[model samples]
Target chain A: MSVMASTPSAPVKPKSNTRLRNTLTFWAFVGPLALGLLVFVYIPIVWGFIISFFEARQTVTPSQFVGLTNYVDMLTDPNFVKALVTFLIFAVFIVPTTFFLSLALALLVNNTTKGTSFFRTVFFLPTACSYVVASMTWRMSIFNGLPFGFANIVLGWLGVAPIQWINKPDPPYFWIVLVTVRLWLQLGFYMILFLAGLQEIDRALYEAALVDGAKRGWQTFRHITFPLLRNTSVSILLLSLIAAFQAFDEFYNVLSTGVGSSSNITLARPPLVYIYQVAMADQNYGRGAAGAFILVAIIIAVTIVQGRLFGLGRAEA
Target chain B: MTVNTQTDTGRRVIDRSERIAIVLNYALLIFLSIIFLIPFYVILRNAFLPSKLITAFDWTWLPMPPSTNGWRDLLANTNANIVDGLRNSLVIAILQTVGQIAICSFAGYGLARIPFKYSNIVFYAILVTLMIPGAVTFVPLFVLVASFGWISTFQGLIIPGLFSGFNTFLFRNFFLNFPKELEEAGLMDGLDHFGVFFRLVLPNSMSVMMSLGVITFIGAWNSFLWPLVIGQRSETWTVQIVLSTFMTAQTVNLPAIFMGAAVSILPLVIVFLFMQRYIVEGVKMSGIKG
Candidate 1:
């Protein structure tokens, strides 16, 4: 322990020598990370904008100037627009429903005095499970789209007719199936966020409200708890939205046609899927890059708007 | 007398409410536990069954008669190099976790404890990168990898995720909470910064770093896109990519895929079971809270 400057300069300004040495050391430590971000992150992002200006087909070499053509095509493109609409519908169905269910789960777990830790761990465990595994499980086992599958098995219990999960039109079965699976894996993660927020709240506030004329159940939550958890709730919501935009794995592996009959319940064009198809399946790198940039723009724009609406700090104070 | 009667009534109501709360609490608990348990059983039972039994869509509490022949077949791949995927994942995860914690601890300590100009800018830049997705950079990184001739190498697998902004940020938060007096004493005794950081700072950070290491291990172990894109060599493929291949299987055995997946997850499950506390703490840092 070296700092004995308790009565020295009040601000304890770091000595100039120390500052210079520290600066060098800090960058030395940060060099690899800074280099990674520059090469792999920042440069590519800016290069994404730059590539949009060029008609760079592959590997960033010998490409022609297609200034604004990609962007123009993206705007006028019918497929892009259709997928955008589909994505909007998907988001609208999933995000709010996921968050509220998470809140309910969190509240349930938070209220239970017995096995509180056990329930929290159990609920949170699935979130750590890989998305590919979860998505695969849903595709093959649970909503396996067969007579004796898990969903149909349960439906049999209630005597309801078996229905295709990702296909049925009237019930909008695809949306429900996709959203339910996503929410099942998702709610636990956010529940922990909500739990953390709950933990941060002053318990004395709840006691004080109880001491006053405030009722125990809803009043305590309404007046004391919910407002305190707003920041965490907003954080969870924003992260979920960001994640939803890049909903690729489920689309890629789970709903994939992968040697299966493509005639069943086809959502053929989520943005990422479309881009992936263009590049990998069809070797259309130009369109793929264009689509990726468009997604980057959409994600950034949406994140900014949400941040403004919710006042998400760049970092907590 | 009326007030006394009213107070008695209120007490009785509170008692009844507590009783109701106790009953309803376990009901919710049972329901939530089922939700968690059911999927696991589905995977487990389905994984052990034959293809015909599996794709038949029978959702039984368990496979009628569990057979280990599927597992025996999978494990029989002694020279099948079934473990190449697991080895690749473990290597990448271990290297990245160690490298990240080492680099980030040094950098985080400096950012939190040392007062340097432009520290905040650097930190903010790292934070901003968190919001950016891997797809945005995939094109350039493709070029970088090709240029390095790392198309199918361990270098490709490890290098891309070597520097983690999230890990750096976590380490910084941990360090900011570190007592400066210990570091000051190290400095007073004439230890240079590196000496102090490695000798003193890291040991104190053993628990936090362990948690971060476990989180990083899981993240790398479970990485998909990067591994799929980078690990083109069959020997370099991580377990996630290998397991995902089963999703594309047509005439493949369901039990074999399950056994493979179960083997893939065995390491993670073992690690998780042992250090769920650190896993929880790591989740707080890498996931839930952030």
Candidate 2:
């Protein structure tokens, strides 16, 4: 190929020149993005790691190094610990719930022969909605702590007393608001993923199963469909786990009193929200940076564990 | 003859069961669809209703004597500066999408096609960045932006978001599968690698580019945390930030808030409706390839 591309006259000199030119072209293509990744991503992360070791109060660049004191302080703080616990409970609740619901939706949508697109569209529409807007809608209108609110209205029809969904966190009905809103916003996106996975399964497999006396609904699914969907399910589980850890916008918009007002509702504050307060609101950059690292460690650890458990890169049967 | 009758009955039984299953499937789909759509219906209805009716003890399915009070209040509220927020969001999302596509695609093509000595090293470096979650770098990135004096500026909002390792990875995957014969033909016509990429590869890869562009645009429009950190000033706020203020502001105007939410969602809804195919395809690709 190189011989054909070189000049007919003075082939040796032209070949070397072409090689040099190819190397330059490669740099021209990849240099800008590599530079960007270094400047924006790599530098900030390294800087944050350094800052986590110091007492960075009201400033990012601190003079005094505190040698893991910031980490110790964050670990010992009840609020920080509580945030971690909150994230744990949230991940426990949301990851499986989203996984199952989205898979169920994909199954339901995929089974239907008519109006499949309509159902998919209706479900996926919420994925386009921002968490801020969805949180507002959930907090103000649907799950608002008033008799006229949507949830209360439904409760009234069911002969249950009007419950203050968010304000009074006792009995912890606030989880209802949080869980349902997140479910509504995310279910469709994951369903689409599962749907794609479902489509890739050979139609002949199901036919073979049926001929082997497998029933259509659960029996076939349990034997064939579910096993085939393992890869999709695992990836979805991982993605949802990450998303649940990053649950700040809804927690902030729904629970906090107002802009810049300290939140009195402290039940479900995730690590990101807590870190945001520590770093942005309280101006304790050291503690906040330390907290951020802890969250990252948890995410990375969970992802690795999940990947190992699933045998992620192993070839499919 | 008796055995034949038995088989016929069994077949009929199976058909009946299948029909019942089909009915149940449609029933569940419709039920779930309504549940999915209820929030949109509620938001739209509430946005057009007066505040009193929104909180009234008696609820109406439809907003009666519909008033534009919410929309009017939202527009007149000077502190929110929602119009400015919308404009800024549009500018930021558009610029970021264009820049990301150009830069990431170029890198992706080179990494996939070019035989550079250090390609593997560069590829692994990019791959490793994907593991570092955004939370780990949020504070320091903010500090970096601040040091550059980019706070409350378009540069802060647009530039940091332009280079996604994941996007570059996607482009590389796409280019790897691109037909080599086409590129060789271009080479035969006396074009260099850059010329072939610009004239042949890019044009042929429009579907992937379009799908990725739509996904990036929607993501940029809907992003919250970074814009909140950087665009502190009202003049630089994205629509998401503006809608957030309506909920968290000192005076919580319920109607105006609903109206703002409705308005903020409009652009994305339009984009989704128009590019629904590409958006879904892009998501499907991410799931399959990631």
Best by TM-score: 2
Clashes of each: 5, 1
lDDT of 2 by residue, B1-290 (tens): 99999999999999999899899889888888888999899988988888888889888888777889988899899997888988998999999999999999999999998878889999999998888777556887887787788999999999999898888999999999999999999999999999999999999999899899989998899888899888888889999999888887778777788888888889889988888999998998777532
User: Each candidate's chain B TM-score?
Assistant: 0.89, 0.97
RMSD in Å for candidate 1, one decimal?
4.8
lDDT for every model?
A: 0.73, 0.87
Model 2, residue B191: C-alpha shift (Å) = 1.1
lDDT of 2 by residue, A1-317 (tens): 76675547666786788888878998899988999999998888788889889988887787689999989999999998998898888888898999999999999999888888888999999998999889988998889888998989999999999888887658888888888899999999999999999999999998998888888788989988998898898889888888888888888888988535456448688888888888988888878878888877887788788777677456544
